[model samples]
Target: MSMTPIVLDARTLKALAHPLRVQVVGTLRRFGPSTATQLAERLGVSSAAVSYHVRQLAAAGLVVDVPERGNARERWWKAAHDVTVADTRTLDEDDPDALDAYLRSIATAITLRIQQVLGARSAMPPEWRSVTDLSDFRARLTPAQTEELTERLHAVAEEYVRQHPESEAGPDAEMVSFDLQVLPDLDVGDRS
Candidate 1:
């Protein structure tokens, strides 16, 4: 049940720069095939708007119509990949605008997701709350070390997923999002 991840190229990244477009793809991927109406209902956007954005995503090859699941009245759309990944380290000055826009959109998405969990933490059962984390670590490391750490962390996560794919998860399993970011402080100024 593991789908391939889409590594962002400049064109696809630009297409996903819009926050809503990015959200549409993520929603379909996370929730499964859905029509524009269903997606709009979940995302609080108009069906027309969602349809338009879905078209844009389709054009960029990030999403596709699930014709088998669709009816004559509405088309079902799903993400072409389960994950969207970008290498911000490769971003240079040539197209800072698009790169920054895409980065901001992702940051906003992550922030909103974390906030939703935080907002609902009080109502969550003790077991779930106990497993939630909202903490950070500070360390002094070279750029190469930071990059290595990032790779190791991501590998560990990927290995875990391979071992525990969704199809095999039991009834007790929950859909979890593991958001990991390894960012270096640019302005240490003796205090980080």
Candidate 2:
């Protein structure tokens, strides 16, 4: 079955603005249902801290308690959806601050993830390193064309991910991360 991507609103975005909350949501998506203690061990944080962030994520509708996975004393949390879609165009025009917060939070999370991967790159095996890549491409297109390109690229990624779910990763299968960003080159017109 195909999972629908959650469309984030200003309120949900604000709730996910915290770094830990963002990490918690990512962890749930990557690792499946887990308790705060398990998440703490994976994140190298305290259980209380993980629990706090989990609550925030739950409140934001990004996560849900997996009651069947844990006893009453221990709560398990899972990501509400497999994918999260954020379109700045959907943001409320009257609330620019919320949009700014959401963008900053997303930027910080992506930057941190990239840094973490780079830090561990040297420790990875040769086979793993061979498949890793970091590249940039420039494109000149109108806003409509850019949106279409983004949708096409997203469809490709989504199809690949659906075929190979993250939860199915095994000993030999490593978690791969992909970041795709397409933006206009404002400097192109300005020689300065």
Top-scoring candidate (lDDT): 1
- The residue-by-residue lDDT of candidate 1 on 57-142, one tens digit each, is 99999999999988889899989988878877565454678898987888888887788789999999898889998888888998
Count of backbone clashes for each model? 0, 0
Candidates in order: C-alpha RMSD to true structure: 2.0, 2.8
Q: Which structure among the candidates has the greatest TM-score?
A: 1
lDDT over C-alpha atoms for residue 99 of model 1: 90
* Colliding residue pairs in candidate 1: none
Compute the lDDT for candidate 1.
0.86
Q: Scored by CA lDDT, what does every candidate get?
A: 0.86, 0.82
TM per prediction: 0.91, 0.82
Q: Write the per-residue lDDT of candidate 2 for residues 56-155, one digit (tens) a residue.
A: 8888889999888889689888999877777677675746777777667777778888888889989989998888888888877878999999999988
